[model samples]
Target: MAADLYPSSPAPSAASQTRFQKLRKRLHKDRALLLLALPGILYFLIYKYLPMFGLVIAFNDYSPFQGFFGSEWVGLGQFRKIFSDTEVLRVIWNTLFISFLQIVFAFPIPIVLALMLNAVRNQLYKRIIQTVVYLPHFLSWVVVIGICVLFLKSEGLINEILKSIGLPAIPFLTDPAYFKPLIVGQVIWKETGWGTIIFLAALAGVNPNLYEAAVMDGANRWRQTWHITLPSIRSTIIILLILRLGSVLDSGFEQIWLMLNPFNKDTGNVLDTFVYFKGIEQSDYSFATAVGLFKGVVGLILVMGANYLAKRFGEEGVY
Candidate 1:
């Protein structure tokens, strides 16, 4: 019995040593690629992970003079303030409404545009259209907002056209009722073409034989797209949808902040702008940090839930 027990010990150690050696060899083989990725790894470690240490400020009465370590802990005091504040609630509602609208309406635009462009037989015309549409995405938000102001202001070109056409001047940008639509429309117009690039790539990956086979079976172009093309790109669609779901809380800051006036604040103020106002403008560091932490947690939960659903449905999700 003693001899048999002693004999098993060396065998286990030898197997462990072999496994370690194999792992070492594999790492050595991929050393160059690992080196190439080191900078990005360090960047996330320093910038992203390191900042998480400051999240403790959310529970403290953080003051520049006191410093993070010297700040007095208040527990959930800041979160309580956020919950009781009606303005913050309004901001949250506005953010959710705009984000929901964008996800619902803006998300499908690129896919539709890609399908339409793919159907076009003329390569030159398709490229021209794509170039024109994609150019807007490269324009700075400031420039885009300036362009919008020129066209949508009370006395601007759109109102002028409406006046000329014997219709009343509609407030496109200034009115509270129109703010959500305007923001959604701007996002769709600016990003749709750039977004289509991925879908187009996915469409290209679709085997031509599938379409040919469908055509031979008396399937029309629309029918072929419905059956073959859409199915081929389903994975890409699900992945993008998961990403969009993750950002369902962030309605952007630059465009809304630049465009919103007192008149449009009800529908224009979002979580980002609210955080800015509370943190930088009012110097309420603790409250702002708490709100931001809340948003981040919600975003993480959304992404995780979406990814889980994607996996459950047998789709390739963001890991």
Candidate 2:
């Protein structure tokens, strides 16, 4: 029994040799593509994966002066404090509300835009419109928000137009009521075009003959879209949706941080803002890291659950 086996003691078996040979052949064939991907692989390894070791700070009562390992280990104490806060409920409510709005109002606009653009038969008009929409996606958050300020402020263009029409200048920036809508609207305007690109690619892969057949069967554009276009891109939609769910809790920091004020603090305080304030502004790194870890864990669970549901429904989900 003692001599029965030790792993890696024996020489490679025939099946193992064949598998190794096949793998070597594949590597040789795909070497050029792998070389092209080398920079991206190194980028992730350096910037993304390597930094995951910093998560240790989440379990410590961390201080920069104390260094990573030198920090006192509190192990979940920070998490407990997070949930124990009386304002935590309000913060959670604000985060969920914004996230929900983004998913419902922002996510689908891309698909709709893609579909509408796809319907345009005039190539020049379509390209022009695409260029116009795509411009916003390239704008930095600071510039984007500045444009919003220029348009939506009390003395801004929008209010000027309203004043000219004998209407009151609405408190769009200061009012809590407008905060969530403004955020959602900003996201929609900035990202909707960029998001549509993927759906358009999926749409391009669709068989044109399907549309022709549908027209032959007396189907209108709407009918063709319903019967062919939407169904063909169903997988893409499912994949994007599953991926979206993974980031549902990550309400952005820079945009919200800029827009957030005493006026809209009740509605605008999201997880990202909370992390910035707690971690950077207040120097409570452990608490902030704990909150971030909590968000990440929830995101992972949501993604896993969504992927499971998609597979159950016979769809190929994002792995």
Candidate 3:
């Protein structure tokens, strides 16, 4: 009578059933963590991933009047423009040179700052310094450039002080020679402290006993830093360097744009500025998007190559 009252449902396939159960259990276990991450995941999906669909316009002779799908398909014609343009090669060269400067100069500032901060024995002073250094990062590029202009301009504070000492007021802003250096300097100032956060966090995880052992072996502070401290953070540094190479194209668009003028355009006109002039100013969206797409592809390749090299060198890269 009981058997007749109910029929058994068919069992799901063993592999699929097991996988589902495991996934469900894992989700349940990490429910709170997933919940916390939900907002960020949603944000990226909405803003970053969804908008990637618009990249299709890069393949077209896109016009506002024609709309997205209605735009004429130009194939690689837009990208062809990027390679054929003589001025673009100069802009590319400028971009590459600036990126090289940033990597060579700006990339190390954070690591150095982290080392300095890590060495500081006084917690109070370290906190104060950290707070001070981090303040600039919160300021927008406009604000930072405004502040820089206030100090670096002809009649600005620095020139005034220089003039007071019988030195000539140098054209730091106007001179093409100074433009690249100034851009790199501004990046170092703004991002050095913020970048140190990752290194500092890594440093905190290092074993304290290593320092004690180094001390027992008569290792001085410099020796300890070079031998123990730097070695311990070697992976962290390498990982960061690899990641830096990935986005080397993004050499502060807003700051450079703000600083650029007719006087410094010869040296200052980078790919970013070129894209802006073509896309926004000249309303050649397809051309601008093609240039941007090239940049993105190059960045992706750099990231992959760097990651492969990192793994070959036995350091965990940003996989």
Candidate 4:
């Protein structure tokens, strides 16, 4: 009975041998292209995938003095501490609030801008307007924050104008109420033009014949846009949205960190900033790692969920 239970492995069929040979021949034919791709593959393997091994530190009471392997294993202790801490909960809420605002308010602006640009009658004006909007994207966050401070400060231009009008100066920087709006505004101003690039490309690929057909059928401008333009770029929008959801937890670390102050900390504090304070500033490596790991898990879940919804709606999604 025991002997009967042990089965012999099947030999490779002639068809399988041919298939393997075909694959080998194809690889050899594309060797040059494969060589060109090697650097990118190696970059991800070295810089991205290789560092994932350090995630184990989240489960350990890691100490730089003891090093990675020498650190004491604490299992879920770090995660437990994260959940039990009230401050961490508040930080998580702030992170989610800011992220939600960005996704809702900032995400659609680029699409609208692209549609408007596509409808422009003159190429010269379109190019000039595109240049003006795209210029802000190249500016560093430090420069942007500096400009904001220069204009939005109590004694600055905005307040000075308000003062001239016998109006009170609004607290743009220090108030918690204004923090989320400021962050969203900065993101929109800096990225909206750059974000429109993909949508514009998608729009360009849309057949002009479709518009002509629609016009012949007595369709109006808005109807043509709704029926032809939006549907053509729907797949591109879905793919980008899925990609966006994958990084939902990453709420602009440099920008938020630069803008964050003690007075606005309640609204400005997020997982990235919290991790910086705990991991780099306070040197609580394991605890901070746990928080980062949690954020990554949540982001992964969001991406998967968004992709699933997109597919359910019969749309092409990022796979």
Candidate 5:
């Protein structure tokens, strides 16, 4: 009765062995490719992952002279300081606010630009437009800010034009209220064309047949775009958005630092600037490390959460 009810155990299949053999064969075939990738692999190990061990300083009252091993351990002490400091909290607020503005306003400009370019029938005009827009991206922040100061300073070109037009001059750079908008505007102007490159590439991959079929079905250009063009690039957009969410706290350090001044410091003080002031100028390495570590942890959590949400929504994520 037992034998009838329970079948005898079958012999183990050689599937595992076969897979191992296949993997070995594939590795041998891709040896040259692996060799080509070796430098990049080493770079991550040496610069990225290996340096992670230094994060231990975040938990201690570290001193450069005392060294890593000799530094007195004050676990979570710096983190406690960060939470208790109103200034730090304010900085966090500024960072989040700027990053939010960027995500909401700056992120979509490239897509819109790409769509407009895609709709253009004249390739020469499109190329000229693209080249002009892309030129700003190559300019360093110092140069960009210099150009901004030249145009946006109180007595600069913009105000001169406004005066000629009998309109009052706007405080584009000096006012705290205008600071964030200025930052977002700068971001859009500098990076929109560069960002469009990726979207334009993705759009190129979208089948022209989809548009042809839509046309045959009596769909207008707007309807074809809404139904066909956008859907085709949906996955690319989602993946990029997920990646953007990962850096939600990283308001550009160089851009903000170059633009930062006493007048707009209240709205412009972000994590990177905070770290620079504390670590470099003030020589408070431990607290600076703690703040940086905290930022990294938050970034990791955000990336993981975004990836999860993306997967849940049936989109391919950056994982």
Candidate 6:
């Protein structure tokens, strides 16, 4: 039995080797494409992967003069300090609140807007609307914040309207209660149009025949949309949802920074803004790095878990 089993496993092993050689040859033939991808590969390596090495700073008493290698290692001291800081808890609360609001309120607006636009038969009107909506996305966060400041200020257009209607001027930007809503509104206004592009593309890919079949079954426009349109785009929705979950911690840095004031600081402070304050302003680089690194790791876990759950539900999620 041993003799028979040991006799020439060589053929199968040789076949595997031959297959490997063929793959290598095929890759060699695709050298031009590989070369084309080299710049992007190098960019990620240098900018993304290389910077990851700096995560060591999170465990150290990082000093610019001492640099990474010579810095004193403090291990979990930074994390302990972060947890003990009262403002840190507030920052975490603000970040999660803003992110949650965005996901809950702003996420679906794009999909609904896309569907509405898709239903519009008039091409000129559709294009005009699309252009108007997407324009805000291209505007710099500074410009968007400036516009918000103008519109949401006590004497702004909205307050002016309130005055005309014999109502008191509302402090939209300065009030802590209104800060979360303002952030949500800003995100919806600036990003909803841009977010629609993907949904629109997904909608375009949906087979018209499915809608026709639904119609033949005596389905109304709304019924067709429910049965055919949504079902067809379910995978796209799942994919985008997974992608969004990946960045759940990243509530806009620039926009929040620009819009934030001391009066609303309690509600407006997020992880990103906190990092700027701690790392750049206070020069506590190590502590800030630890906080940021912790957030990143948690975000990764969330995305991966979400993607896995989506796959388990038989949906196409971001792998």
Give the whole-model CA lDDT for all candidates, comma-separated.
Answer: 0.88, 0.87, 0.88, 0.89, 0.89, 0.88
Could you estimate the TM-score for every candidate? 0.85, 0.82, 0.82, 0.83, 0.84, 0.84
lDDT (tens digit, per residue) of candidate 6 on 256-310: 8988889988889999999999899999999999999989898889889888888
Candidate 5, superposed: residue stretches over 4 Å from native: 1-46
Clashes of each: 0, 0, 0, 0, 0, 0
Q: lDDT for model 4, on a 0 to 1 scale?
A: 0.89
Considering every candidate listed, which one attains the maximal TM-score?
1
In model 4, where is the ten-residue run with the lowest total lDDT? 1-10
Cα lDDT of model 2 by residue, 40-102, tens digit? 877776678655778999999888999999999998888898889866667877888888899
Q: Rank the candidates by TM-score, best first.
A: 1, 6, 5, 4, 3, 2
lDDT of 1 by residue, 232-311 (tens): 99999988888888889988779888878889877788999888988999999889999999999999999899889888
RMSD of 5: 10.0
The Cα RMSD in angstroms, rounded to one decimal, for candidate 3 relative to the true structure is 8.0
What residue pairs are clashing in model 3? none
RMSD of each: 8.3, 6.8, 8.0, 7.3, 10.0, 8.4
lDDT of 3 at 117: 97
- The TM-score between candidate 5 and the true structure equals 0.84
* Model 3 stretches with alpha carbons more than 4 Å out: 1-50
Candidate 2 residue-wise lDDT at 12: 61
Better of 2 and 5 by TM-score: 5
Which pairs of residues collide in candidate 1?
none
**What is the TM-score of candidate 2?**
0.82
Q: Give the winner by lDDT: 2 or 6.
A: 6
